[model samples]
Target chain A: MNLSPQQQKIIEIVPQGAPSIVEESLFEVRKKIYPRAVTGLFARWRWGMVIFTQLLFYGLCWVPWNDRQAVLFNIVERKFYLFGLVLWPQDVFYLAILLIISAFSLFLFTAVAGRLWCGFACPQTVYTEVFLWIERVFEGDRGARMKLDSGDMSQVKLLRKGGKVLTWALLAAWTGFTFVGYFTPIHELWGEVWNFRLGPWESFWLCFYSAFTYLNAGHMREQVCKYMCPYARFQGVMFDPDTLVITYDTERGDPRGSRKKGIDPRSEGKGDCVDCQICVQVCPTGIDIRDGLQYECIGCAACIDACDQVMEKMNYPKGLIRYSTENALSQHWGWREILRHVVRPRVLIYMGILSIVVSAFLFGLLTKSSLQVNVIRDRGIMGREVEGGLIENVFRLQVMNVSEHYQFYAVKVEGLPGIKLASDHVIELPAESSRVFTFEVRADPESGKPGSNPISFEIESLLGDAEAHEKATFFIPR
Target chain B: MQKWMWILWPSFIIAGVAEGIFFSLVNPQELYFLGDPVHYSAIATYSIGFLAFWMVCACSSFLTWSLQRPAGEVNARG
Candidate 1:
């Protein structure tokens, strides 16, 4: 490829003598990134997602469902309650389906646009942005922060660093509390924390989570996204030429040179770029976008805002750097044409699978039963002869009430003549509780001739108005 | 080498004891020993196992510190 004079100049001006390629040496220290703040449409959109995701994550733990915490995954109780759905261990397949659905959705979105989740909605980016904002408030903007970090440790520096650390610690602690709130009841957990009555395990986990949040978000920051995150490594597999990414338009911005305002740069054989490095200054990863797309770029579009502002000041059209596909940038295709190719067969298939999985999940949730029953026959003994000429078999019945209200279940046995319950037919079961009862089934000796007989046990809840039936075989001596 | 191993060995023993304790607390039904009449022996065995696991992890720190000497030498030369 033949580069234009402007391209040659840009190639020349980009920090000479630094290693332009990545190396495998493990001991290399990372350079600090001091990204200047910028405001634009995409920036606003990123902030909106930050607020939405954080609110849902932090707020959902406090929402009450029935008399218990909503969205609780009680591993100890072996139950997951989400809104009105009570998922027992047997329903774990639904979680697998949910994960598949989420994966397919990610694939579909990545096919359309590259790294949108990483730029906006990822926990690392969102929480890091929040922690940076706090740091900015306590210390100052990028320049002030750089100066403070390099200067001697004075009282002012101490106060600023102390305030920032304290704020970060408080946020990390609150995040940990909210996370534990999903497993333990938030209100009760709060009481325990306030009274210092937390159990050993709870205290350990709270401290562990808080430390992790503090280290990852406040200190590690972009290092986590760059080196530690698996997504950065795997994102290449999801990207295609049609996937939209933030790119610099090298063609229009060639023959670059600095010029005064209102000067005809193109007439003077110069490009419209004016050789301003605003884009590089505003990048969060400290990489020059003009060097082409690198894995370090999270596609936050801060460079686009910075470049557009520079273009506006120079009285030129904006989008010297903008979100564009490789094909569109190289071939100058219209957005609608690019969008048409974005919904290709691969993306459509992913979308179709995601929709089916989501529909199946919703259908399962809507039609789920509020009652369940399990019957276990005693293995120690076979059928026995009672004094009343009734053959008896011992069985244990576990009746679970999944409804919001208490239920009285009437147990009934069928498929044999003269079948009777050993105790009262009705058993009171509390809401969200399972009760195990050992009962005897009595039937005539001639019900089946010296072999196993198929029997059905049915439990009907009066409060929930639901019925559950379980089938088991009653053994007879041959 | 001998000094490093000595520094590492105690941490390994402690880590093993900690892991055993954790597992027994999580699933108490899994612990068993042959010819152990008293249950106290089982408890003591679990405690020792957990302490050994913790010690193993902690002992690895000495190994890491020893390995860093080469990197430090390289930086000093540079």
Candidate 2:
């Protein structure tokens, strides 16, 4: 083969061992990150959060209350049980308020200290940490795991990989089971699992959630935060100069290079950083903090802990990497000044609104009525003339006994002269159940001049102080 | 790849919230589609509703993202 002069020159420029140019794809395949495990205050905090959250998630469903799951969203029964409180479809306003509170709390927390939810508490991070721990038990830590992955497919490698995968699968399955348990009666669901009698939908959800947990935490890891989290994309907008963020003290740590310990770095014209790269090794997201803050940081503070240990060993003051605000980092402010800046106007507004909403939410929960009555006028039927020359109206009443006891309720109709219940005025209702009944109310035709008269149904529970007043319009022929 | 993520992920989150709100107010047992009663159970209805909302939201997001692309790229692709 004859080579052109240009090709010859290219070959000459490229050394014999150097490979030819490789075309890059539009989508970059991820290089796997093997974060070394570290132990420090923040790492312990992360583990603490993992235990607390998982306890709530995996244990809460088994807790019994009123002969049922304490915190169940029983779609089968069309009721949400939160301990003593039962929320029906009509009480969905509470769900909206709950969502609003969540959104506001996110904003408040983000403004105060960035990605606190994502770092220590997020299911994604916590689950990943757990899966990594399991991985460590089988394959070993960062260096060994990396070497094993890079090495030949030996029997040991296969066994370790298989064991890790099996453990992860069991944990993921357990997680998925717990998730489905929230919407179904866990006791019954557990029996169904043992008997192989799980419903199709139940099986589908269990598998779906298992796959989700496995893929998201075990495989995807930081990719979810970097590429897929909606909060990650919008969190920049939530941040101000005073917002506390995981920071690298570039001013203090610049001219970073290695030196012998106990030797003053100033004389050597070097900074506190030993260039050991432990901070980079410990990073889950695999970014150097010295390049300044990036969106990829989940604020996990593994780098901070890693660097602090290095600083301590080097006999220097700690906090080479620390939680600090942009303003504080730039202005070289002390902790006092940083705290003062954190109380900026934006933070105050967030805190103020958060307190208000929290109080309101508590108030709503505390004062929630135990009875619900919906007076829906039956449009299918109109006011009719009964045998006594009286005007009669029909209403479809949906009354819910939101409490935990069977009770008798008396229905009274008013808002017209001598208006009275024409049908059975007393209804027997069971605990936490709703019933639809056709209520008949009659009024003297000459009670008032009326086309559509406003009326109210006064429902009083005979067993307790629970009562409901619902309004409906009664029509009279002109 | 990233463009797809930008469209899908935000819409996915939004769709989840929408499903929660919609199902909370309208019980799946009582839901009717185009004057036809939904025969599926509450769990099935909820799942389908979430998927349908997600599809709608993803379409909206994809359209918005495609429209905002550089005019040269859009025209060249066309």
Candidate 3:
């Protein structure tokens, strides 16, 4: 780990004047990144996830569910219908728990493998990759694209630019439409769009989201990851020396210099690195892997793929730049030690909590009642005495049928003797709708001390499968 | 200050108006609904009041952004 006198001097001067250097803030503006394509294990894995995720997203909206959209977040109706489960607004806590779980999962993943989500599964990464692929197809590869940008305004350049823009715009618009389809029914939304009958809000959001997609994915690209993303900035906190990151094996690769192919590096006392710059060329964020691990490296493993290819060409062993921890490279720790560190207490706890939360959510969904009853006491009148010497309390019952089919529920009162329904006992609730019914409950005055008597209402479905019980207080005069 | 103000003010107004129109159309009935006609007008008044309040908030944010110094200057201060 010894540094040369010149390197030591450079290191000493770096900190002393770093503040003043940074204060100027006028470094060369980063050129647009044209990440060269590479093929390897991780690259294939990334593409696999991209296809899998996109298929699930696009396919789920079209899946049929009992004469309705398969999964609809009917925000207007304050209900979310997902296959068999109907989630009311009151069940929004589940969504909050889901968000918490996702956040913890991010933390856990980041701690284990630095920025794995950013590199692989993040929507930003996935969409940007797609957009870049399209750009490559229409405009050509990285070198061609760079050349096109530098060229004069010609018919050929215009045609390529025009075609790329049109493609990007269409894809971005479709993405936005698909996003809105999650809230509104996709088929119905398509019909509405086709007929030019899209609502004002729908139109606005469609345009807004489309514009954002175009700007962020198509134009902003790596700048979004490098500068704008809060995750990139704060992710440093989650990183440790043991965390797996895309790193250069400086010990093996350094004193890095250009050499002819098939040359013996050991005899020449030269390092294995041929200084081809393929790793930098393939990097989406326009970073040099040889510069050491920085926040900009998303651990995409493009460098690994690039370096592997270079190593193969040179007849050298691969992994000059690979997914490895500092401990692994520095201390030459084995994969077993790395695995032990990865599955430590923090990750285990996150996994345990996530499992419990997911199980509880599933259990709640499974055992949830399809019929719900909510009682609202008439605010105008408290309580009155009937001609039969029975104390009466007026209540409004909002009965909701969360199921797809019709349900008839028989309302019954408990917690007071001789209490009877003033109206018909049986109430029929339509599918996916609430029914308001005003009914009076009769109880003996001496049943309870009088100011407020605790009462429970039980609504049992005539089908006998689903039942819901709600509690309320009934006021009785002294 | 003027350049930043010009950029921020329009965006603020645009976003505010867009969000307002969006939420309004999404739940028009809920926005207008009141228990009774007498209560309806009262609720409408309150809704208008809140709408104005939000618009002002948006404008004030624009102002705040405009009043702030340039990033280079801010960093120099730090």
Candidate 4:
């Protein structure tokens, strides 16, 4: 067939031996994986974790501490109350430190045991597991779900599917509500729900988070871990030969074939593996463990549980698939031997860094001043010469009461001779709140030289012994 | 930084243009922070929004890369 000049040029640009369109397409269509449920030791641990985490997330908002939510991030009030500790927006460095600590913890954990967080504790895994359980309750097991999806639609199918959707929506919406509750008071949020008067921003966040949770957990499932999760992509960089990962013992399980119930695997000239494929069936990511430790494996150890059960039934030794490091497997080292190598230099370094960060974070929190004073010079007017021959400088002082109780603060100025607070120095600040006050500092023109003299504002709490001193630049006429 | 101008320039232009259009369409006075003298709260708000937006953009970029890959091929890590 004759081709256009543009098409001819495209053909010339094509490399030799490159896969044609028929061989490989650009886009990969997703094939749905229906993971078969299997009961095992790790499965029980996962369920336990699900219960533990969900309890803390859904129930923590209701628990009262000092007549307020136990762990509330009151964004509106710009206060973060974590049990006994109250933090202001100025204390965001603490949050950054918290994030750094979490990152280091992940590094340490991933280096020691691969994807332990992903399998058991990560929100994606936990929520997906819960959503799957909900789906199983409405529908049936793996086989039933597969059949229902492929089969014709019916009343039974409609009811079950509809019921599942409704349940998931309600759960996701409640999750969103609880999430919003951490920022807004849960009781007040509940009142708003009753009155249908939730603020637009709050309502938007609630819906947005709910929809995200539902799509991630209910529909996307493993796709979130496989495609979207950056952690999954980058976690391999943290892995080493000593890192414990889910592995299949290819030396024992290879040369595989099926066998009768009572027949010995050696008699049939085959390895211990009967090739039942149960391990693959139970895998969340639908990868064959026998193919080596792939990044796709979350190291949930469900395959270990499945393979062990198969080994037991066949009167064979267990651990055909288990959590073993590359070095351990290569050296044929057992559990005790593996434990010794876990304390190696890389892990020690991570631990040392983590400890330093943790201690520093704790020290910062412990020594945090209850009274915080931030003085900003009024930009509208720099300085003025008053009738009394005093140089007056206006400033906006933001005084934050970081304690749980109300505080009475008295402001005083220092650094220049005869420098004194020219406005009301005493003010009452509410509990865990900040108020911006316009205050004037006056000093005799002869007392200090012109053009930006350093001054300090001392805030002393009358209600408590807490006090803070913040330094600001005082402008003077040149 | 200069070497990657081909990439950085487009990203910078997109961000700057988008920010301008967005601020104009949604009067920043309606926001909790009125611009001019930037407050700590206003800075914090913008910082968080920038972080969240960048993360979402990163995720979408990854997805686009994934779509461009040949079928049946998997990402291999060394």
Candidate 5:
């Protein structure tokens, strides 16, 4: 390898043992962050949410409904059962609507209180909190964990580290099992687990999901929030000046200096902040809140709690760091002023759109037809001349009963004159089941002209007030 | 090279082993040996599916790496 003149000059100027040009390329080495545990109003609220969300997730899969799981998305059967409502493949639009609603809700929330979902309800945040709790239980607090890592490898260290990993693995495995149980019936899946008879896909998903949970929640932690989350990247666009963010009041907190207890900060030309870095220590993403709002902040409000506690101890007013809008902080406005701006144009628009979408979604779901009929013209032979000078069109009808009870449907064909069904007009369908049946439609030979004729199939459920109408092209030979 | 290996090779091996375990357990005979002895077409389909899986894993791994990397930021002193 020959070095260019520029490379030689660069090497000469650069110090020895420092990162070389090639080594100092784009990729940066990762330094592990040990977040200290803090207890405050926001921390308690986060724990409360963690408990509520985890309980709901782990409990939902076990609850039985109509002798089966209450919320099962049986992909193999291509049916999604939600309580009393059974959504067939044809009802996939409802799922799309649900996703749209979620996205809009996120937009509304971000416009109001920035990153509340990331802080409170996101699965990554929730699982990481749970895993951290488990780790704390096994290997003391943040300081202890850091010391254990820095100290030489020892018996006690191994035991504590091993215990943490084992606990994390168990929790991850249970989470994975519950995830798979959604697609497969939990009770049946449990029986399979006991008998060691899980099918290949089931076992694969179980291990894959478990490994992912373990690696992500236990090891990856805030890294999942910082780089992997697209929402974190795009959330800035949704933010406004009036959006409530976890902020440090630089005006009140700057000119910060270390002072003894009972020393008036104002008299000493110092701000309320006592120069304690508790806020940074408690921060999950390892960013200082005093440096202004950064994109890495999940807005968990841990810094608020930590700062408030320090203020209380120092007899200073609270909210040295608190949730305030950028506009409020800049304008020196009180809480009432900030609340007034919360209902600004952007918020109102989002709320209006969200409400309309939600209402329409509800209306669509409530008025969902129980009967689904799809008519497919046989491609191989479009139309044939059967005996008796009649034109016959072979068609396949896919009838799906989206209800929970057996229903008989009567099928009728109408379009051109003398168009009649050649097979059984009335068919029985099992609950939440779909079947494809091939039947022939015959039209009078002299009634229709050559080319494709428009025809319609009317399926009326005999069991309920549910019916469906589907149109298909009926071809006729010249 | 060592640093790159630390990120790439371990992840590659883990993904490969995981895929092997899944395939061996699932035994997707239909995907790889449909109606006949194992043919090149069947192998091609199976390989394509595996390639798709690896691509997804690579994307996720890259995201994780980028997030954890230290950006040479100087810590603020108050």
Candidate 6:
């Protein structure tokens, strides 16, 4: 083997049996993973998740409640309508709480099961699965895909690739459209799209998001999980010995060698693994679980399903590779023991924090006030002497009815000696609407000191007992 | 390629998160520029704001990565 001086030095620096560093670092070329389709319990569950999430995302914006879109964020109108409840810009507290809830939920989920979200629920994983299904539909399974990629350029290959790409693009476009639909009214958006009248920003976002979906799911594949995702990087810290993760039972499946089916492995002094490499072939990340737990493992358990079939065929007990904790695997513990160990201190702490945030979020949502009010001192004019000997302060009141029913609110002012509203005392507001009312509040000339007097407005719904108390300052000229 | 990704990718993600948090708290209609109300639509505000945020974040990342290079590489370049 002829080697340059630089190559010889690199070989000396690297440990024996490691793949040549030169080959790996030169281009950093990515080998596309052609994950073979596997059918089993986990596969079924994955498909179920794909269907459930896709249906919810694609179909949810079309649902109407109370003659309005049920869950429209409505960025243009600056309102968030969720079922019977309406949230204004001032309700950003709920959004913060929702984000906190999601973070804690992720923590708790990760503590209990290693990468369960990555395996079953992450958008990256789910989209990849959907794209793979489309690929299989158009180009056939792993073997066919590999063959086509390596084979000469042919008419059949081009057609197959074209069909797959077209389908993937359509699905991606729909995904992006549905996402934008959540912010805008879906039906109205459909009308605009059909008329070729999409707003510039809307069109830009639609294209940007569609391209993102195509590149990430179709092209990047495991690269997103292995490199791009921040969650994947930090999730290792949350994992413990008791966390359920995809693992290969090395003690039971060792001295791996190919053997005929139905042959008892004990007779030849071999383990269950037949050196089939089926697990590697089915891996989305192209990792061998028999090498033990790796960060690259998303815990999707396709390897487990693949191994179980191999184990069953070889007249061996299943679960050569399966979902088992580190402690369970090493100690040879049963499911009951594994369950007992899962409630450790780390998991309990995560669970406790998650429950607290979730409950706080729910409580805040349920007890949210039905009416909101903001008092703005009219900037144009200040204290004025009215026809009478009283000092009056001009103000604008922004009142919002956050409920689903129309009601008349009795508005009054107080908090200073004889401070009374000079504007109409009663204002009617439609359901889920806000209005700015300009009103004047008068006070006795000698009320407290002459500079500024504190005042409060009492706006109470006449139909319901809901009330909003807003504070404002009234100025009296010296 | 790897160095470019180290700054660009993470900053891109952070910019998206920043946009979400900022927009949720402050409505575009209420925004003002130089004492005059911003006349752009909500989508335009969000898009421009996101891009502005991405630039700021990417600048910070670029500075950090560039400064933290190995002494050998810096000396070699010089």
Which model scores highest in lDDT?
2
Cα-based lDDT at residue A127, candidate 5: 95
- Candidate 3 deviant stretches above 4 angstroms: A1-28, A379-383, A444-453, A473-478, B1-29, B32-78
Q: Tell me the TM-score of model 2.
A: 0.87
TM-score list, all predictions:
0.80, 0.87, 0.83, 0.77, 0.78, 0.87
Better of 2 and 4 by DockQ: 2
Candidate DockQ values, in order, are 0.08, 0.48, 0.11, 0.06, 0.08, 0.54
Number of the top candidate by DockQ? 6
Question: What TM-scores does chain A show, candidate by candidate in order?
Answer: 0.87, 0.89, 0.89, 0.83, 0.84, 0.87
Candidate 6 per-residue lDDT, tens place, A436-462, comes to 999988888887688877889999999
lDDT of 3 at A64: 84
lDDT of every predicted structure (CA atoms): 0.79, 0.89, 0.80, 0.82, 0.83, 0.88
Q: What is the lDDT of residue A116 in candidate 1?
A: 87
lDDT of model number 3: 0.80
Q: What are the per-residue Cα lDDT tens digits for candidate 1 across A421-477?
A: 777888888877888988888888887777799999988876647898899877766
For candidate 1, the lDDT comes to 0.79
The number of residue pairs in model 4 that clash at the backbone is: 0
Clashing pairs in 2: none
Q: How well is candidate 1 docked (DockQ)?
A: 0.08
Chain B TM-score for the candidates in order:
0.39, 0.88, 0.37, 0.47, 0.53, 0.90
- On the 0 to 100 scale, the lDDT of residue A105 in model 2 is 88
Evaluated at residue A406, the lDDT of candidate 4 is 79
Order the candidate numbers by TM-score, best to worst: 2, 6, 3, 1, 5, 4
Between candidates 2 and 5, the DockQ winner: 2
